[model samples]
Structure formats: structure tokens, C-alpha cells
Target: MQYSDKYLAFMGRAPKKIPHWEHWSNPDAETYLTGIDYYEHPRLCRLKLSQLYPQLELPIPEKDDPKPRPKLDLKGQSSNVDEHGGHHVRWGDTETTQWDWGKHFKDAEDVFAFSPLAQGDFTDIPVVESRDYSDEEKLYQEYRKMYPKEWGDKAPKGSTASVSFYNTMFMWPLLTFGWELFLETCLDPRFERIMTEFAEINRRVFRVFSRLPVNFVICHDDIVTSRGPTCSPKWMHKYIFPCYEEFWSIVKAAGKEVIFMSDGNMDAYVNDIMACGARGIISEPYTDYKKIARRYKDCFLAGEGDNRILYRSNPDEIRAMVESMVETSRITGGYMMCIGNHIPWNIPPKAVKYYLDISAELAHR
Candidate 1:
């Protein structure tokens, strides 16, 4: 099968074999070629290829030099005196520093500053309300001009394009508002209204993109905790699912596949995800693949290798995990093998190579 054919099969076009590729371990441009070569290798001629091009660039932060620890004063006060002589009240309810909420916005004009939108800082700003519709349309047009294949590329021969919106809803609320306040807002009627409004705006942005010829719409929203979801199933059902249903339905209606990426164990929400009309869920290997495959046969599954094991496990252990994942979940189709999450930066490069080489060998079987 060609790469497109294998990808389509994974997306439920036909009963076919899963594609095999090297794991992304090296933080270098070579990873892309390695993936392409893995699919093109003679042993895996039966599978198809799907090339993913990640275009986002981030500034690397400067590292700090290690230093000795400073001694503590231990008296809940500073030993070194300043111009104020460190004589200020040490303990008093009235002496506490007051928070100025006004500092959040620099000024009244800052309300419409909209500088972050130009820089791609979609956080905190209302994407729908803040955006100039004409400018957004121009941006979309430019993207389409640059990568016509992403939208115009047809199946059976060419690769499809997928773009991801940062996991704004989940990230913003937790980072901007305190966690306690965010949770409280979920229960509050007024806050729920705000969430709904934001969700609608997000849905509109997606709708505009869906009108283009893209093959897939991917959204990243981390919904799970170490144990389960941060919000209860009932709460998600009440506040979150409806927005997803609307969004997923719009994508499906537009004839584009929808995939969601989340982290952590998500064994409990597989049904809820299917109900939202998402074609697949990507996450770490913590999710119970066998259970999810048995329940939602049509829904695609991605990422099953345990991320932590990549840093510590030997080649044999990695091979075993890959073999078991393929044997158990790829039987009925709709499975893609990937690291449970992005390969860690500190992992030895050799271990990463071993994981990919082993995965290729297993998939050939």
C-alpha cells in the first residue's frame, strides 16, 4: 500500500495493515527523513505513508550555570538590612500586601491592543471577538497558497495536511485563573456562560478552516488527570461535551477527520470521546488500548508506547511493548503507533533509535 492508503486505512477507509515507522527521539531534522525512509523500506512495502510537517518554531532559552545554595535566615525575616532597615511589620493581617487586579490590563486602550494575535499568542484573548475577520481570512488564504497540497491533496496518492490549535481552553483557564477559581467557575452559572462563549468562538475559527481542503482537523486539549479527568464525567457532560459535539460535528460534516490529543490515563472517557464524533484520540500509552478497541471499533487509536520506559528500558523491553501493542490493538484496524507523548529531551539518542528500529521490525510481521 502507498502511504496515503495506509493512512486512510487507519482512518477506517478499508481493512488494511498498519504502517510502521521509526519513533521520534532525535530533536533534529533527520527525524522527518527517518520516518519517510521507514515507510519506504523494502520490508514495509505493503504499508502506506503519511508525512507530518511540523512548522512551529520556538526560541531556545539560555541555560543558567549551577551555583551554591544560599543560607536561610530561618526567622521568617531577612538578615540583610535595606534602606527600609527591614523594620517593617513581620506579622499582621493588615500588613499583608494587597493585590491590584487592575494590573492585569496595562490600561483601558490595552483592552483592544490585540498585539498578541499578530504574534500568535492566542492565550487569554478571545480569539473570535479579538480577531479582525478580514485579517483571519487573509491568513488562511496565505496558508492555502503556501501548502495547496494540504487542502487539495486527494487520497490514494498524496499526503493530507493537519493543523493544530494550541490547547487553549484547558491551558488558559488553569494558567490564568487559579485552579480553584477555574473549577469554581465550571460550577458557576456565569463562568459556564463564559466557557460556552469561548467554545463557540473556537468552533467558528475551526469552521473557517474546515471550509478549506484540509484532510484532518486536530485539536489538543489535555482532559485527563493522573487518575482520570480533572472534571467529573457529569461536569464534562454538562459543560464541555456539547461544545465538542458541535465542533466535531462541524468537522465531520465538512468531510474532514478530527483527532484530539490529550495526556494521562483516559480509560474512562473513551465512550465520551466517541460520542463527541472524534475519529481518534492521541495520548500516552497509559490508556487501556484493548478495552478502548473492544468498545469503539471504528474510532482510531494513536500512541501506546509508555513514555517513561523510553528513558530507562532496554531494547528488548521496548520491542516487547511494541509487539504487544500491535498484536492486541491493530487486529481490527484503526491503530497508529507513536510514543505515549513527545520523546523527552534528555533521553539518550541511542535508546530513541532502538525504539524506532524495533517498532519497524515488529510492524513488518
Candidate 2:
């Protein structure tokens, strides 16, 4: 829960300018508590490498012990299946990714037969016809049963990942069907009905979600792509936005900080996302960070530490990128640094270190 308050405070009530760089430099700074990564890249695992570099405020692994716990069948019947019978496998044995949809659309009809969603041809929902069953219907049923980290009496006494709550409530619906299907459905004329069923499925999950003691909840729904939206903006307004509203309303009602995270050129949705009640907007580099940080002063703006610059930039360019990003984050107040997308394996390890060094320097300033 470290810096959770500062993160919440800034988002809950961010001021126009963070005049004092001193507070940010505070070793106890709330910003230090924030760590976000989704990658197979070795550089992302700071804790594992931290002992070699003690000076950096690198990410600490949640586990105090390296000894493995009893391996639960995280992937179930089909090698770690979730409630929807989706296979959940890690990518290249890294701590970062869980390969699912990008691998195959879980629970999709056999006709899909493991083909990518783009391959299918459907006039209606690309997924099987929608279904809304009783509350007894579990979404991440196997996931919960297999690995219940810090749940109930088992809650840890201290530091864990920056995200205290591991939740996929919003994303579960998206994954239950999948991105391709969801996008196709949203574009289809029957968008409302299809999305409604999706919403109903989420309702059942959230009903269970309400019981959890989590203050920070991340709603991962990457509805955008490099070009723009995978779904049309108009479709987003009518069908998708309502789903978001319904999904986030529960978090808002529970007095939680909604960290709505998205991946691509999602600048268009910043205001709408904030309007939908997200206290924090976790985004990637393609998003307009400067505009969001400057304009949405009251919201926590995260992840503008573009790795693309690090991947290709010379030392000077990397420094400038870090300085500008750090400065903007400082001016905006509630900002958490993150690399663009994943820290791809090709990225120079030195570059990552340099980025962190600059961030640490900025943090200490």
C-alpha cells in the first residue's frame, strides 16, 4: 500500500503544478511505489537483478523467498485454463507475460478452431452466440481456485507488486470472447445486444469482485491499435462506452481508484476515460502524455517513459527523452514511469539501465 495514498491523493485531487521537486526526490516518494511491466524481457525483472545494482529503486519481487510454492495448475484442463476454459501460459518463461488471446480465442466456437479472429467471416458476432447464465457462472473460476494470492485471511502483511489487487474484471469479458470478436461485434449492427450479454457476464464476475479488499484496480482493455481504434469511434461511443461505464461503476461505487489501462494511440479516449470515472490513466507512449499530464492535472498519468527512444536513440536522445518525460510527470504531479508496450527482448539492456538511471536521478532531484 506504499504511495497508494499519494497516487490516490494526486488523482483524487491533483493540483496544477508540483512546484517542489523535493517531494518527488523523497526516497519515500509515492512514485517509487508504482511499478508496471508486461513483458518477457529480462531487464524488466529488477528485483532479480537488484542485488547486483543496489543503488537503484528497482522493482522488488513480491516473494521474499526464491523457493517455489506448490505449483498450482494455474492453467487448467487445457494447461492452465481459466473459468472460461481459456489456456493461460507464460511467454518464454518470463515473469511478465501471460500468453492467452494472442495465442487463441478461448471459448470461441470450434469453427474458429484456433484460427485468428481476423481469419473468420461472420455477419453477426464473430464469437459464438452470446450467453447470460446465472450468478453461479464463474469467469476466472480456475484462476481463483488455483492461485489466490493475498486473498482473505491469506493477505500478505507487507509489500507486494505495485498493484495490490490482481483483477481482470473488465478485461475478463473482453477475453471471454476476445479482442477480434469484441471488435467485430462492436462494429456489427447487433452491437448493443452482444455487448449487453458481455456486460451481463461481467456483472456476475464483479458481484464476486465486490467482496475483495482492493483499493487499486486496473481495468485492462486495449481497445486501440497503432493506427487508431480497432473498433470505430462511433461504435465505441454507443456500445463500448456503456460497457466501460457499467464495468467501472462498480469500482467507483466501492471507493476504489480506477486505473484504466490501455495500449495504443488512445488519446481520443482520455477525456472519455476520465469522464467514465478513472482516477488514473495507465497508458503507453503512443498516447499523448504531455497533453494528458498538462490538461488532466487531477488524474494520475502513467507510462510515458517511451522505450522506443531508448531502443534506438543515442545517449543524448535518451537523456532528453527521460528529462522531458520526467519533467512533464513532475509538472503533472501524479505520474508513474513505464516503457512503451513491453521491453522487447531486442532492447539493449544498457538502454534500460540508462532509462532507469535517469529516472532515479529525476526521482532523487
Candidate 3:
């Protein structure tokens, strides 16, 4: 089958090709496609597609029917926003309050001194505060009022939205606290309580946001190392799985899909992750996609391209990577391809363009 037909069928849409590429780079449109504005750089998309399909034209269709807008069922989820303004931290800077817990520990001796034992009591740590329901409810009401313009005329139609709680534990804790202290906390009961408290906060947030119109929630919490998971699967099942299950159950009860995004090699805990109620996983290319696709054919799969190749490799290499990823992920069903992570700032803009362009072409082939 043609790529467009396959994608439409996969999405449960009629097998007619849609003019999706023309609006691929629009933030509003792309968010509908990938669940985030992570890659709304139109120039990048344009350049990438031009390189991948040099002979193919990407003209905006003339006299075409106005395409229906995408709608999602965010019944028990919330939008993760940086209401504080500014992009969330991206490396560097030592004293930012939002530094990952690990990073905080690395920089602040005081935090290390205050580090709690893995099994230590956290009953006194104060239950994490919840968002004001009135405020959130008002926001939702306003959002619903504006949903028509924001989402056009489409209603929930088998579309999904990716919603993550926050950055991964690996990235967030290490950055918020010093690595040593963060590690200590991971092992200590007191630290576990703090983590649990934060998880509660996430739960409350999820409750508020899920009331919106979305269908899938992608919770991100990386626990893997380059070689394998940093902690034992048992440890994750003990400390993290409960939180995931709680939130995932909420999402699933509201009839939305749940997925997780992690980094590094996670070959050992795929079963555990699946048991946590997630339908798919996203990560950098450290894990084996072939194994994952074969093992979890019922779940969705996203990510797995090498960022270094997009930044430094030639066009041929980029094309090869795209083809391999698309083929590998196109296993039984439920796959979407993207950069292993955010595109590096140093990668030539043209290289980024070439990568995305090829992906679009392949998706429509």
C-alpha cells in the first residue's frame, strides 16, 4: 500500500490521502501530528523534505476542500506548560531552581546534607501542593470556549496527543540536585518520599488536564543508562511503577492511551514498563527497535533516530537512517518517527532540513 494510505488506515481515517504535508510545519498542525511543537521549524522541515525528495514538489493544494482540524480527548490529562516563561532549561547554569534533582545535588552541598534516606520517613516532608481547581477549571472552560478556533471543527476522531509529566528522572533529578545526592536520595527512603510527593503533584496535574480533549499521555521518566537501566527493574517497580500505574489508570479510565519516554538502553525492563500500563515507549536510539517492535506489537513506537547522524552525517547517511527507522518501526502498526531527541543547536540548519524532508517523503511514498 502507498505510504499515505497506510498512514490513513493506521490512523483509522478513510484511505484517502490528505494534504498534511503542506501544513506539516505549522505549529498548530504539527502539534496535531506529533503532540508537541518540538519540531515546528518550517524552514527545517522544508529543507529536509527538499533534500530527501529533490524531484517531489510540496505545493499547497489549490481549490482543495478545507481539511478538518484534529481533535483529541484529554479527558484526564493536562497540558505541561512552562507558565514561568522561557524554554525549560537546556544544559549549563548551576543554580537554576528548576535544575534537575541530580544536578542540584551535584552543585549544592546543602541539598546533599539534607538528602533523605531511600527508606527514610517522609511523612513530614509535606504533601506536595495541588493546583487550584478553580483556576484550572476556569482555564478549561475558557479553553473549551476557544477549542473550536484552536482545533477547528474536528472532534475526537481516533487522534492522540502526547503529554508528559516533566523531564525524565535521570535528567531532572541530576540537574536539580547533585548527582551524588540525587543517587543517595534514590537509594534512601526519605528521598523516595519526596519523589512520591512530586508524583502526587503530577497526579493532581494529570487529573486537571485529563479533563480536556486529548487521547494519549506520554509520561517521561528515563531510568536507563547507556548500557542498561541505572536502577534494577525491581527498584523501578517498587518506587516508580505505582506512580505510573496511578496516573496511567486515570488516563486509561478516561479512555486515553498512555506511553512513556526514556533514554538509553532499556532492554531489560520492557516487560516491567509494559506492566506499568504504558502502551509504548520513546527514547533515543540506544535500545534495539527490532526487538522492541517484535516484542510489543500491540503498542505504539516512536523515536529511534540518531541525532549525531543528522548533525554530522551526509545526505546518503540521513536517507539510509530514515529508511531503516521507518521500515523497522512499520512492523505490525503504531509507529511514528522523529529525531532521537531534540535536534542539537550546532547541527547545520540544512542538515536538519534534509532529515525531516526525507521523513515526509518516505511517509507519503
Q: lDDT: which candidate is best?
A: 1
After the best TM-score superposition of candidate 1, give how far the Cα of residue 277 lies from its true spot, in angstroms.
0.7
Q: Which stretches of candidate 3 lie above 4 Å from their native place? A: 1-155, 167-178
Q: State the C-alpha lDDT per candidate.
A: 0.56, 0.51, 0.54
Per-residue lDDT tens digits of candidate 2, residues 189-230? 544544555455556545444444445556777767765676
Better of 1 and 2 by lDDT: 1
Off by over 4 Å in 1: 1-6, 13-17, 20-25, 28-146, 149-158, 168-172, 175-180
Q: Candidate 1, residues 140-194: lDDT per residue as tens digits?
A: 6654564656436332233456656654355434433445555645565555545
RMSD of 2: 10.7
- What lDDT does candidate 2 reach at residue 50? 52
RMSD of model 1, in Å? 11.7
Compose the digit string of candidate 3's lDDT tens values, residues 168-199.
23343444454566666666655555565455
Candidate whose TM-score is highest: 1
Error of 2 at 133 (Å): 8.4
Clash number for model 1?
A: 5
